[model samples]
Target chain A: DQQVKQNSPSLSVQEGRISILNCDYTNSMFDYFLWYKKYPAEGPTFLISISSIKDKNEDGRFTVFLNKSAKHLSLHIVPSQPGDSAVYFCAAGKGGSNYKLTFGKGTLLTVNP
Target chain B: GAGVSQSPSNKVTEKGKDVELRCDPISGHTALYWYRQSLGQGLEFLIYFQGNSAPDKSGLPSDRFSAERTGGSVSTLTIQRTQQEDSAVYLCASSSRAGLNTEAFFGQGTRLTVV
Candidate 1:
């Protein structure tokens, strides 16, 4: 069973435009959500994350929005750049910080310069 | 290095052969986890170790897969009589602690190819 799902396999956007990636989860017990970005031949790196209590969290150009009632979340990269192209995975965990995370299949984002 | 380290970045082994993958987590992190990403698939949890507590082996795909952390630092994941389906990029991660506020750091991953 895929508790976390990123339905889109890939997305393409123009540089300096807004890029949004969506994710949905079936497990409501998951209270913490995270986004990770991976480049070819490299391990995934943490991006932005949001806690259940909050609806949005922003760091520089990346922002994450969580809707508990919808069991969904999205990562928005404003003014997307070519370097932002990569595979983005959505992960969720229960019991807060020290929990095992369930990951989505990932969505590959390509930004054209 | 400040980041998690994984050895044998690439390994090609014949089917039925056993393989051992190693991981060295950040120096002070106490929570270690193992995950694997198959081709066109998401990261699948494998196992987890936290301090002296019993490791969580629930995510292991089969009896042929096993991992152990020695001295609470370096970890080794061993696959016995591996199958082609076992080929994937095995990743290791570590966190200062497992809980609400900590984030895990991952290694580059060991890519295993079973031919």
Candidate 2:
């Protein structure tokens, strides 16, 4: 079963606009969430993360909002640039255990210049 | 000084053959993990290793797949009797500690193709 799910397979956004990607998880044990951006032939790079303790975490142009009750999370990039175009993966893990991350199918975000 | 490094960026092997993939974690990092992404699939957790602790092998698909971390610095993932279904991009990652809410650095990944 897919514990984590990214319902959207792909997303397209215009430059300078805001891009939002959403993810959902079925495992209630997951308390930590992370977002990674990946390019072709490259590994996923860590972008932002949010602990269950907080509802939101922001870094520079990227922000992640988590809703534990809903078991959902979203990543928002303001003033999206072409460089931000890549596959975005949402991963989650349960704390204090082995905490091996469970990943979603990933969303391909394309930004138009 | 460097990030996680995985060797043999790409490998092609025939069915029924055995393949060994290697990973070199960042110096002093105590946590390492292995994951694989198959075609049109999400990243699948394979195994995990922490400093001196019993490795987590629950994610391993079968007995054909096994991994060992030696000296707590390097890891090798061996796939015995490879099958076409085993084809995927295998990724390795490392973190400073285990079971913490910290991000793990990833390697470029090793693409394995079984024909």
lDDT measured at residue B55 in model 2 versus the true structure, 0 to 100? 92
Task: List clashing residue pairs in candidate 2.
Answer: none
Across A1-113, the per-residue lDDT of candidate 2 in tens digits comes to: 99999999999999999999999999999988988899998888888888898999999999999999999999999989999999999989886353578889999999999
List native contact recovery per candidate, as a fraction of 1: 0.64, 0.60
Off by over 4 Å in 2: A96-98, B99-103
DockQ of each: 0.58, 0.59
lDDT of 2 by residue, B1-115 (tens): 4788999999999999999999999999999989999987888989999999999999999999999999999999999999999999999988887742345788999999999
Error of 2 at A74 (Å): 0.6
TM-scores of all candidate predictions against the true structure = 0.93, 0.94
After aligning candidate 2 to the native by TM-score, how far in Å is the CA of A75 from where it should be?
A: 0.4
Candidate 1 stretches greater than 4 Å from native: B99-103
